[model samples]
Target chain A: MTFATRFRKSIEYQVVEELSRSVRWDANRIVVNTDAERLAGVCEALAKAGGIFDSAVLSSPASTRVPQVCYAFRMPDLGLGVSVFARGKNITCLSTRLDAAAWDERKIKDLAGVQLDGLEDARPLLAHPESGWGDFAEAVSKNRQTVLKPSEAYASREYAMEGTGADGEFEIPVGPVHAGIIEPGHFRFFVGGEDIHRMETRMFYLHRGLERQAVGRHVQRILPLIEQVSGDESVANAVAFAQAVEDLEGIRVPERAESLRLVLLELERIYSHLADLGGMATDVGFYASSSQFLLLREEMMRQNAALSGDRFLRGVVSIGGVDRNATQENLDATADALASFSKAFDELESMTLSSSTFLDRVFTTGKVSAFVADELALVGPVARASGKSCDLRRHFPYGAYKKRAVCESMAASGDVLARFNVKANEVKESARLIRSEINQMPSGPTHTGEKRTGHGFGWGWCEAPRGSCSIFVRTDKGRISRLSIRTASFRNWRGLERAVNGNIIPDFPLINKSFNLSYAGTDL
Target chain B: MHELSALLRAPRTDEISEEATDPAIRKVAALLRRRSGGVFSRSIHVRMVDAGSSNDVEVEEGLMNAPQVDCERFGIHFVASPRHADVLLVSGPVTLNMRRALEKTYAAMAEPRAVVAAGDGACTGGLFKHSYAVYKSGRVDEVVPVSVHVPGNPPSPYDLVAGILQAGLALDKKEAAKSGKS
Candidate 1:
């Protein structure tokens, strides 16, 4: 049976029938006006009936008559999406039932001052100790520039970690300022001798208030800002933001533009995967193969710089379509570069997998069994490596992805080796996809030749190198009213904590590099 | 490994131009590279701090350690601690969350320490300056004094090398000031 039919068969529309709510606007959005108490039951029923939590966004009173919160969910098998709007000064927390809602609810509670009644942890999500969460709530609600005194407000928070209670357990505090060029995040590990008993992550050191800064800006003006959300996934986030805006205005992107965008996304996926693989190799102390991977990455980046002015492929994706069209010469150059990259990449892959030391380190180290991954709703390679078929491209295929089906890579072991295998296989898949898209390249304008000055609420998602970078944009007139971006990294971080529970403290960096979650993406 | 050796010996079509390198900078860099175990300590240990970047700069920084750029050949090596660093390479605008961390890190650096502020964001705060959650200015100079400015959205790998070279000049100036000779 089809998923929608299955969903309908599973549960009657009893929740809505019981509430007697009027369905007001969109085909997917079920508009239910009910008390906070009734709304919780309605959500519980829908979630029980198979609503995968997408993201939760709480808007200021300006967006609604009262302070409002929307819990977004999508059922991939059915290709259906719905938003549950619960309007109140204090909204009910879906996290009571949904494990995935904890992070989103915590963020809402901290940023909007909406008390989540059953929240287990009351610790601030973004604010430092002395900054006072109240000032932040006021500033974000006011949506204006506010001063946070650097001396007092920006103090490093002292995170309290309960003792593991095992007689020999002790903590190893790793960084807000780390070695190398990676972003700042503090990780606390409690270990008894060599084995880690527990771990906690303290981030927001790289939090630059991306959502708060995006308010009241023209859609076109914020493309560059959105591109910086995560540099490697720049094209992916921009495409998601653009698709969300385009869907809002009911605009259609031309065929050629769509094809070009697909190529960009795939190209980005290739480079992003390479960095992770290279990182894994480095962590394993296999510098020779790591250096080779880096060389390959540099070549692809040079090609990106040639096709577009920016190497990360930023500044090219626009709201309507794209900023630049690919010339035949550029396409041919890219194809040739990627062709070489594939050949060399295969050799490097074999070299990496054949190395016994590398295998010994990554084989069963930091394995996240299928059950743990499923419980956390981890996306991207972390989930894929667990042998879970959670590919968004296969399930809710959008844009040019609807035309060409992508075969996602998955491994059953759910270890660092499995992640490596998945990433390497994905690199090959992306390279093949790029070649096919270029050959089937549609001929038309790169952009729709339309400038937008109107707005609506729309959702867009593109499979980033990491995984699904799902975005929701709400606009009024031309300015952005609310933007809720849930990057794969944001959802996947919890999986890291679970994955590292039984691993050694020394292997933490290796396990971390395996997942390679973006600190900035998660913080944003 | 044989294939890797062959690939290394093979000619590269996309050869990065030497013109991007300045003779004076190379002269100093060569001096540093040759002065190993000397009082000059030609090998400069760098510690990098990312304030509020998109991680694009980090990618480029990683590439610098790759076979192509291989920054260690020029006596510039990235160290793990600020205490051991002779130079500090920083990327991104100064975010409020990172302000104290950056300041404390800078303070922890030993004397003769030179800071190279990499990327347009680090140089001038770029697109992130006005955000409420960020330090209003966002520039590296707003928190810690910068010796050289590397400008680009996220400056190219070559631009970063040049900026690091300029930081060599800054180290000398810092030394001169310390000796009451400037």
Candidate 2:
């Protein structure tokens, strides 16, 4: 028996008596249904049984069914991820036990109108003063044309910065409208004598009701909309969304298509990392290094445009297949571009590393302890920098990753410098993987294997430049029933609060840039 | 010679012409020539607001400062506050959450200020206007009247520069229209 099967069999044989009567595998997803009364015991048993908490999935009530809320778990050792679901209007709060589930459960409260019985924080997740309660059903419903807007401000408008009870603490507020060419997000720092006691981040200023807009849309038509969830992560989000739809319909992607997807994903990682690396240098006043990095980044983008029609690599990905032909000629040109990039990048990396000024600023700045990272369940480079061995490409191989091994770059020191080192090493690994995949990729017709009529649910993920991005897609007929996008930024954004504690106010920008969490992705 | 050097030495195919080529750009170029008589503004100060874009325009705006397409060399500079700006660059479809913020930024700007809607989202709300979290249409013009529109899913760096230059051209009309109204 496979590990997941063995684990299930052991539970059946009384290894875990509470969950034995409740669990069964729906294909690869282990579905556990238990009464609300027995839910806590089952969850505690499952966690002891090596289940890592992912996110909680929420769905509004259908005419016949009650509102359902599900908590997803990943069995790291067994290569299996499952969701424990319960149907109710008021579900028990999983965050009370799992710290990682707080943000998601809070969002579920706002979106589906499902209250968590024991949840501590009662703030709105996506509802704004102007867009109060979102009229969420019409926003995501199939029959709906224009999304519903709230008439008048229906709820509390301001974000209350809950005090840490520190005496003489004053607040320093920064942008939803910032200084540079960046997105809007408000950060309120509760400080006493420049020592930040606590920082509260207010996002959703960029929340455009992505879930509501996507719910009733056909799976095939949502690719462009998916790309917009986070611009820098366009290709990564597209691949995840496409793979989920493919999984829902049981379509098999061609090897050539898989290889092409890998190349594009790696290229996206390179450019995204370059921007971050350059921004780090710029933040530290090393303008020359920043310029070099941006020049290099510009070259990569030019090459992206040459390969794909759009610079952001939009319009190239479609459900079940890619839109553009990733012919041998296109792949060869990309190889040549990457070959040049590697040499230029090597020199830049050495120059940046050797700079003592840069190192002094980044080292020991914004340290996230391994313990805290674990508690928050951080993913991506942020988690890996703190020595969390959880790259999705390595852990749960899908698409091209299943065909070949991914050698991940990790760092033990959870600081800005460590995050920088992790990204620098990853860029090289991605480039190496791209070259190897291209050399061995088989030649074949790029499109095949899709059935559009039937429906089911499946999850897809890939390691984005910053971290692992996962998409959960449940389909009803041909349209999406529910879509939950969990970006690496979403998990790590929470970790930012803990990371920045005790660091000076000025170092905040450097550390923030290092994490580079997406406001759009997180808010969505 | 190193391949990196050759790549760096490459003539960029995406630069805006010193002499105008596109008809809209020609109009701007002509006005700008008269404004300084061939001498560009010491700095065409710009302040940007992300109204509701997918951030493609911001990516392009950030790229405009890169060595090849450096907007600073041409005397166009991004400023810290709207109070010092001669032009406003807005991206995204204006979300309901950001409508007041965008308007406040525009109101803070000095007279002769021109607004350039930088992406498809900012121009016509792109794909997100109808979404509930966004303003009714999400167009920058709906919130703050736009002087120029650079429409792409995101317009390229050069296209953004041309649009900014067009906003530079529109500055003269703000004066003319002001006098005309009086």
Candidate 3:
């Protein structure tokens, strides 16, 4: 038996005895149904039994079904996922015990209007006060016909930010509109002179009600919407959503399509990391190396445009498989481009490493200790740089990643330089993976042509360029009833708050660039 | 001696030939120059405001600053504050949460300022038109008077440059109108 199967078989009796008698399997996931009151107890038991918190999703009430909350966990040793289901409007909060579930719980409370007893932070997460449409769940239930309050009423609504209140500490409020070419997010820093005492981040200015928009749409129609979650993470998010629909319907994607998907995903990783590296260089005033890195990044974007039609690689992934096939000529061209890119990239890396100015700025700056990384449940390069082995591709392999071995690049210091090194090494690894996948390109139809009719829920995940992106989908007769997305940016934003605690004021931009979390993805 | 030798060995700069310019950008650049009596052809400060985009538009704006495009050569510079700008480059389908910020940014700009909506979402709210969170189809024009609309899913760097240049022409018209009024 496979490892997941063995683990499921081993856990079946225990789940029945402790949690619920309705224990069953949904692919590699172990689903256990329990009462709302026992939700906290069951989650605590799972944690004690070596289950790491992954995500929590809330599905609002409908005519046919009551409100439900599903908490997912990952068993790293066995590569299995466990989802506990609880049905009720009022549920016990998991954040009181688990720090990682704090934002997830807050988001659930905000979007669904679900009441969580003993929730630590009761403030709104996505529903900003200035957003004329207040109480999203109420608006959804009313079919969006609720009268919007006057702008002036919300004009006075403000978010609360508490400072340390030290002898000379003062608060500095930065943007929802930043100085650079970046997305909007507000940061409040409590500083004593130049040193930061604490920092609070306020985001969701880009919230466009994506999850509510996906309701009642066909599963195939939502891929384009998912692509807009983040511009740079288009392919990874699309793949995660497609895989969720595929899992729900039990459709087997073609081997050729899987291989192509792998190629597209790794290409995305390379371009995304190049931007981070270039951004770090730019923030440190190393313009020579920064410009070179940006030049390489632009070349990669052109390569993406040549391979797929769009420069951002949108409209390429579909429900059952990829929308278009890569011709042999295109594959050959990509391999050739990657070879030259490798040489240029190596030279730039050495140049950056040898620069004492760049080294002085990056080393020991914005350090996120391994303890903080684990406590916050950070993912992607941010976590890996802090010596946490939480790569989703290696832990929960899917598609072509199942057959291939992905070498996880790691650093223990968790500083800006560590993040830079981690991202650089990941770019090299991604290039290697793409070249190999192109060489052994499979030959077959790129789609399965399976009927899209299903009445169940399933989970899909992919290790995006930034970190793990997970999607939860529920379908009813080929139409999506509900969907939830937990992006790496959403999980790592809190980690950025912790990372910027002790750093100085001017180094804020560099530290922010090192994390480079996506505001659009998190807001969505 | 080593530094002098390295400086001497640096590559020579080449003149930008007519063939090197994108035709779309050249057309807008010529229009802007002719309309402004060659004044704006030397300098046009731009301030960008992201109302609520998926960040594709911002990425394109960054690429416009890259070496391949190098918008500064065309006298299109992105400034830090709106008070220093000659035009506002805004992208969105304006979310209600960002509507006030967008309005504030537009209000912050000086007179003779022009606005360019830089993406399909900013022009017509693209895919998120009907959502309740966004204000009135997410169009930049809903919140501000737009001089130009560069409509793509997210416009390419060359298209963005053309749109900014078009906005520069609008700025010249605004200045003329103001002068006439005075």
Better of 2 and 3 by DockQ: 3
Provide backbone clash counts, one per model.
0, 5, 3
Candidate 1 structure quality by residue, lDDT tens digits, A206-291: 87788867878887789988988998999999999999999888788988888899999989988898989998989889887887
Worst lDDT 10-window in candidate 1 chain A: A20-29
Q: How are the candidates ranked when ordered by DockQ, highest leading? A: 1, 3, 2
Best by lDDT: 3
Per-prediction RMSD in angstroms?
Answer: 3.0, 3.4, 2.8
For candidate 2, give the docking quality class from DockQ. medium
TM-score of model 3 relative to the true fold? 0.95
Q: Which stretches of candidate 2 lie over 4 Å from their true place?
A: A1-21, A36-41, A59-65, A130-156, B1-42, B176-182
Residue B37 accuracy (lDDT) in model 2: 32
Candidate with top TM-score is 3
Q: Candidate 3 chain B — worst ten consecutive residues by lDDT sum?
A: B10-19
* TM-score of B-chain for each predicted structure, in order: 0.80, 0.79, 0.84
